[model samples]
Target: MPANIVAQARGIVKSFGGEKPALGGVDLAVTPGKVTGLVGPDGAGKTTLIRILAGLMTPDAGEVSILGGSPAQRLDSIGYMPQRFGLYEDLTVRQNLLLYAELRGLPRDAQEAVFKRLLDFTDLARFQSRPAGKLSGGMKQKLGLACALVSTPPLLLLDEPGVGVDPISRRELWAMVAELTKEGIGVLWSTAYLDEAELCDSVYLLSEGELLFSGPPADLTGAIADRVISVTGFADRRRLALTKALDRDDVIDGTLQGRAIRLLIGEGHPVPDAAALDLGPDTKVAPTPARFEDGFIEKLGGGPEGTSKLAAAYREIPPSDAPAIEAKGLTRVFGAFTAAKDVSFTVPRGQAFGLLGPNGAGKSTTFKMLCGLLTPTSGTGSVAGFDLRRSAAQARSSLGYMAQKFSLYGDLSVGQNLDFFAGAYDLSGGDAREAIERVTQIFELEQHYKRNAGTLPLGFKQRLALACAVMHQPSVLFLDEPTSGVDPVMRREFWTHINGLVRRGVTVLVTTHFMDEAEYCDQVTLIYRSRQIASGPPDALKAQAGALTGAADPTMEDAFIALIDASDANRDEEAEAA
Candidate 1:
């Protein structure tokens, strides 16, 4: 039923360097003036399909047509944005835009008009002169989007554009997308997030390089609408409840939302009653509608039915009795720009603390200082009782840091990367080898042991990065956008490991754009424009924002947006008073 098909593939099959063909007899279509989603988990051939559509790769046996001809011949008619934005770090925002515009051969007048429109919509006008390398992650994503939109091609291909972006930014980006679609520009969006697929006009579900299903998200979700059940309790109890619920044969998957747990019941298994399962003296359960994610999980074998055990044998607890991480008036400056201004916070031992903010807000700068990667301009901080300035090595020795970018030698095999990180953390000989083996099993990287780190899928890369960072088992863990680009099911499993470690006394300092992930943290801090604008428990933050916005029991996303709005209002008031 698609019209004006801008991109289409039939019986597509592709293989890579003598390996199994990533794509096998796949068929796809994208129409003008509509948003089409290519939804799949890691290693599902979504990337392979995108490559063929963009003429970056050839199909072993199939035909791909773009704008009625071969994809390679339609480069000027389509705009593409890969997962990695491919921006020149040294180039200024304006410079990058101009370069992309020139590459597309847009006239000078058309380029100026389009650039102005893009900067305005992306909210990057003020940062035009700033170097692309210096923009925050979220801002950088917007700039990438702007660059892709420069020529406004008839068709657009966006690959996971919202992977690590915050919900607010994601919404903003989608708003721009909606406008573009109305203008009759076709969009092919690839994503691992099932929830995002629901926004598309049509969705093609891929699994293991084959089409699992293709249709509207509503119809897909409706197929399993009768399976979901809602369970409620306080945060601590909710987590315990979910962990315990997994024991039931009927439970497929469960995700925690503040104090509530949404569980998917399996058709083949029998569900136990609440009273029989010890759901406290006061508890209730009711059937709820299924989400696209619930259906996706059901299709994928219900995911590790029994509990996935998470236990850490190594511990690096310091003898001194200071908080796990302490930053008092921490400040860091680059040239004339203050990346972190008067930031102070304390993460107690065994607590999971989340650092959140818009791009370019200094969260990474603050994280670097605490992890000993960068020195603070002023103030003092310590990790596990080791002063960052006086005992920088000691401080870092007690902590593990996973950077936003998967920082590992791409050419090196997974085993080599893990071994290297283990050595870097001072683990060598049999101990390092054993540690590598343990993490390989725990992180589910056994099959990819001999594969090059870069050659593995995005999800596998994330697993490798986490494995390398945690190989030494530091008492304090610093995770930056750790779950970015991971599918929902894997994301749940990843959090299970984090929570399990927290139970065993590992303190976590994490930065993430996923508000749901923030609920897992014991505390949340929102940093804006290089300052800590707000900090508290998730519920408390929501309650305060709810009080002002009249939103009853607001979700974390709602609360987060309200807090930013309030901060902006305060600035306006101060300026008016002056």
Candidate 2:
């Protein structure tokens, strides 16, 4: 091993059973003083590999090393932040950081210095005394990072650290990581976001537990030289039609971007005939540099990439004429605290409506009220025309809900859980059996059907939760952070399943922290501080926010951050004036 090498794994092979192999002969190396990204979709074995390196789990066959020693023997030299960092919400930010610092056996003076620097970097200095549970999703993520950095281990491994964090917080976290790298701490960061992969000094692309490519991001782009083109001017409808038409050709890979599309053609492949297109005269086509996403697509067979089949499925619900859910002047109060105040929204039939906000911005409270789990202190609402306040059960029966946590019977097998959910929905005999079979096959759960839910991986558990929520095939579906902590591959697959459900005419009301996932929604409602700050298509919201930031083209994340920051500034100024 090289002198700078902090972690190394050779010929790693892990299997859950005799049939399915999760990681196959994978070789990886992480160098000190650099950030190495482990990028892949869900079920790509990112977590499994990271777990092995962290000494949290053992590989069936592999040679693993950390800090020039065996991983198991050098556990104290590494700090790992799992997808779910197992944070204790009840603790204050300072308390959490202090606890982790103590666990790492840091000296009192050193711990204080580290804690102070972390607070400054994470911008959590003012919120140190606040309960972590009360912090926003983004803030919680910052705390998680702070806790991980408490000891300043030589090797830091992070698994999807930005999964549910807002754009501002995500950027801040990346900045911290970059600073750590400069300090000569070897960092291995795993994420599904291709855009994030570009920030790493080097990347290891994994697919279905197999290494697809390992090199600098620039090298990956160079491999697909001169193949990417950006085309604009087709509405989503025409874009979809065109994508389908172009997808028929084996040599092309296309992905939708706002009102435009990016196409990557195989080397020497003929370009599509422009005259054959139904494009407007304003349509513009230009060569564009291959991005990390482009490189990922090329490695993954270059199809219209973003979220996978599951993502598309989750995003594809048909348009609805009838109001599936309606909340009029909804308000929720806990003593002197007002969680949601005068929040109102309506979801048309078969539409995918998104609820977005900071962690304590009342998004979850509103979601619970809409689902009939929490009665609003003041308001009138209905789901599938059933009164939300008075007829909670009736409204709930017409809707399916999947909470943030994967809430399934851990002791039961996947099949047993599906059966239980089917029974809960009142499906019987053949109907229950058929529903179970269909969902299992669709989600590719057959391989793990007999496995206990507790024993399954995070992605599989998420799939099972989704399957259970939709077993009765309710007209309306409510998903709360369904993609949280999921790997990129699995997230894509999960969205594909969701899109399929939407095609069958299910109305989806989803609350998620993933800004990219917001784009997949037909319409989005941004809830900030118990109020609707913005509502519209992703493009429109982005455009409006772009007008303020002076960015000609603002991404969803950019728009969201701009809007929130602007809102907070306005609030602060108002308070000062008062």
Candidate 3:
């Protein structure tokens, strides 16, 4: 007996002008009322397959059935959200909904009810009159989602639904997804965040255009549950232990989590005892449970922790006596709106400094001022020891910047973009050719050089953007939410390149929503409502916030939320007093 399948694909194959096909003989099925996850590395064919399911593109060789009918026939009954949802920013939220509703041919009676339900569920009712362009990043994403759901289709195809959203908004979006499935609407969700995959009823793992495995998320990781282990060594010997562990063929992957090293070993591989690595008698070793990430990384051949030799503090910048970055009483304004207010901070040589805040919290304004893209309305700032106001050209040349959007030339091939950026650094002929070759290999962009920058998967685009930004190896690097839509596996690899740069004495200032990634920073500065809220080491900030919240120990995410809540409460009290 066949299970109740809402959508199915067999022998799916697709090619996008490459030696390798985008999808190679893949298979998948969607069950009623269940969320099916499609996850894989960038260019693993997730988007290609989703397009096929949505009837936007046809597979070169295969069969696809949506609701047990030809995909074309069921197009009206399906709701699809692309990675970059094309919401008309100039239109008001309600206007956008009206457009989608009209397209679905919903009568006035149905349209009113659909609008009410979508607005309520997405919590966009209050902002329905606001122009979509005026909304925060998170709000815009929610409005886009509401537009997709306005039709109340029986099936949903969402590609990376939570991209670039903060954790709280991300949770809210997932909650909405869960409710849709409860109404017996089958959903196919593709996500870069592997943790989200665990929430799906079932998952299909893709890699290099083929299905590697398909089953419950736990089943994928739990098979090697006993192989995951934690090894504790003295702080002095931790690096040595990591080197030795990674040198072994059995050690699949390892990372420094807190004070201990967590290892994901292959099946049948013995746990790495500390004594084997020449650690003192005080070393502790214990088995740890495997996670979906462990299995995913292992299956994908994720090896040895990634860190860049050039970016990981391998060498010191010559003649580096001044601080890498300095900001003093910086302020920016647009008419009556104050985007950044009296912000001040500093980053010394060879340090990884993190800047974090929620959407529209003045982060972008402040970043722009520091990058010379926008002049501060008042006060001053400097990058790479050059005053942004007085020496803008030197400051610009002394640093590399990667905007949150990846800021690549959409129409250019990967090689062309690299060549253009390389030219900006004054490299040409043999020098430009050498730099391009080096970065292409370093970032594993050799195969993607011919691909259009904008057409690559989000993860691959992230790698290319970073490669282009660092082609000149500037002394200071500013990355704004660089991992917004990337997966956990790729994030780790991206940081390997960053850490390598830090080691080479390059100064780094990064903004990110992933608080866990903030743990890698030497210091973190928190901003809220255009003002600096807190600044210090990651652990210290968390502990202080934990004390205030009455939690003995709080994770970074919890501490961040606590700070925002506390700060808002204080501001309210102050307003009442005034």
- C-alpha local distance difference test of each model: 0.83, 0.80, 0.83
How far does residue 472 in candidate 1 sit from its true spot (Å)? 2.6
Question: Residue pairs in steric clash, candidate 1?
Answer: 15-21, 136-360
Candidate 2: where are CA atoms >4 Å away? 1-3, 10-22, 55-67, 71-76, 88-91, 130-135, 225-256, 261-268, 274-289, 302-321, 487-490, 496-504
- The candidate with the higher lDDT, 2 or 3, is 3
In TM-score terms, which candidate is top? 1
Using lDDT as the measure, name the better of candidate 1 and candidate 2. Answer: 1
- TM-score between model 1 and native: 0.92
* Native-to-model Cα distance after best TM-score fit, residue 77 in candidate 2, in Å: 3.5
lDDT of 2 by residue, 283-313 (tens): 6677777877767876776453322344333
Lowest lDDT sum, 10 consecutive residues, model 1, at 311-320
* Model 1 stretches astray by more than 4 angstroms: 1-4, 17-20, 270-272, 304-308, 312-322
Clashes of each: 2, 25, 20
TM-score of 3: 0.90
lDDT of 3 at 409: 97
- Rank candidates, lDDT, best first: 1, 3, 2
Candidate 1 to native Cα RMSD, angstroms? 2.7
Q: Per-residue lDDT for 423-499 in model 1, tens only?
A: 89999899998898888888778888999998887788988888887888888999998988887767877787777
